[model samples]
Target: MLARSIIFLLLSLSACPLFAQQKYIMTVRGKVKADAIGRTLAHEHIVTNFIGAATVVDVPGDDSVVIAKILPQLLRLKGQGINTLIECTPNFIGRNPALLKKLSELSDLNIVTNTGLYSAVDKKYLPPYAFTENAAGIASRWEAEWTNGIGGTGIRPGFIKLGAGSSALDSIEAKMLAAAILLSRKSLLPIAIHSGSGQAAISAFEQLKKSNWKPEKLIWVHAQNGTDEERAMLANEGVWISLDGVSEKSWEQYAGMILFLKKRNMLHRLLISHDDGWAVLENGSYNKLDLFENGNSIPYSTLFTKLLPALKKAGVTESEIDMILRNNTGDCFSF
Candidate 1:
């Protein structure tokens, strides 16, 4: 009887969800403990091919030139104390896990990639099959990337990324959201959606509620585009408010938004970043990289050089800043 009681107690503890799960975030290199991702810029892009999915061609060969152009910026970011960067360029829009992995190795920074389709800009970035495939089918593709690895590179995605074009979720966007929810449920990865507007963020949140998905799993990327009321409402609903797109011009506005949320005790729900990246300009016979005209003269340094100082001037404590840059980011991306 004593042996049986001990065996049952052990089995019960093993079956508990808390004991059964281990928390970690997937990086281009591999998985790391959640606490290890220090001072993460929650959203940024390495390189984006805006040539659209139909005309975009993967120019095979060494990515030396592209790496040459972008590597210095990443190294500088590492110098600025940013330990991890969440690369937000979705698959068709130049989601290169292999390239990200190479950059990560070269710079010694934790770079994360995503596994989902971008359906924004009138579905220009989406592939042909995205239209014909159902939600389950689309989800299966993303889930396979999470389980196995992206495109056989053996590097997995850390989260799900979806793009919405407007306030009303169009058919393709709705389908993509459904697929994201499905994949998130299966893989335990957070879903970050590029909301085109405030209503779009609300719409996505409502849909998640209808699907019975946890609001904490949904990140409203580009939440800076939304109003304070909208941001407050969604933050109250447990959605991760990603106030990305910080730049030299926008740091003050971002600081104000952060303080507003801080006043409401919603600082823990915020994620901040510079939506800074390079746009691949493909000519007839050559490709060139153009710094995104997002108002940051520098690539990834404004958050440290400009915004944080402004927040500090406004009396935002270091621990509160850490909550946004370190704790919130790790929690949002960790599975």
Candidate 2:
């Protein structure tokens, strides 16, 4: 049956005169055709950086430290059939593009890196420079990175990211968001906002509207906490509504969200993931990383191991499943 399916796909594709002009996912290494991106985790952190983290927590040091902790998880994600993953850890708070390139090379799976700043955690996460920079100045920073490369690593970003504070965007967070919209307008890469709650998510959406940016270009991350009406409204506007609730505690909730999307006929705009990441191992050393939960990053295997079966049991069809895990995610990355 598989052989027949492959042959049928080949025959169908060969019949299309415009097949070669098809767009594909933009990865750290290069472009990838859609078919090659088998299944994707839309909002995951293969490697998370937590610099200036409040309280006491482990923050991985240099590239070696991060690679030592995250490479195994990348390979494990590949083993579990996740062909592509998006690393949403933004700048300052430990966004490492070079490490992402290396991991992609070693694991032979497509890993995408992002540009922009994160401000959801606290004002401290916002760099000192962010405080003084105007919106255009901040945008120029991201634009330069996108045009050239971030930190001289020569690794360009695949998407724009912003972390809006809970309930609203503070002054600096709002500036970063403005930069995100401007970047999207210039580069056509979609923007993902780590919104804190329903009100904050809606406020960001209103800002996007005010800026005349297409609603489709906005992705409201962490929107799972929003009311059903709010989520549906955003989904109705064609924005990507990401419900990244993939852990032992939230797996059932994740499945329920999928069922909700299916019922509302909004699965095409839905993005799902563990939102989990490999821990920033203490001291850049890998002495048995029992700290996977230390950084809110569960194993990459959570989606494939725990959630897939539950989604199936919840009456999600194979085609719908493929659309959520692969197609929607691939669409999210198509630059």
Which one wins on lDDT? 1
Report, for every candidate in turn, its global Cα lDDT versus the true structure.
0.91, 0.78
TM-score for all predictions?
A: 0.94, 0.85
Residue 46 in model 1: lDDT = 89
Residue pairs clashing in model 2 are: 277-297
Off by over 4 Å in 2: 1-22, 53-69, 281-298
lDDT of 2 at 210: 91
Please give me the total number of clashing residue pairs in predicted model 2: 1
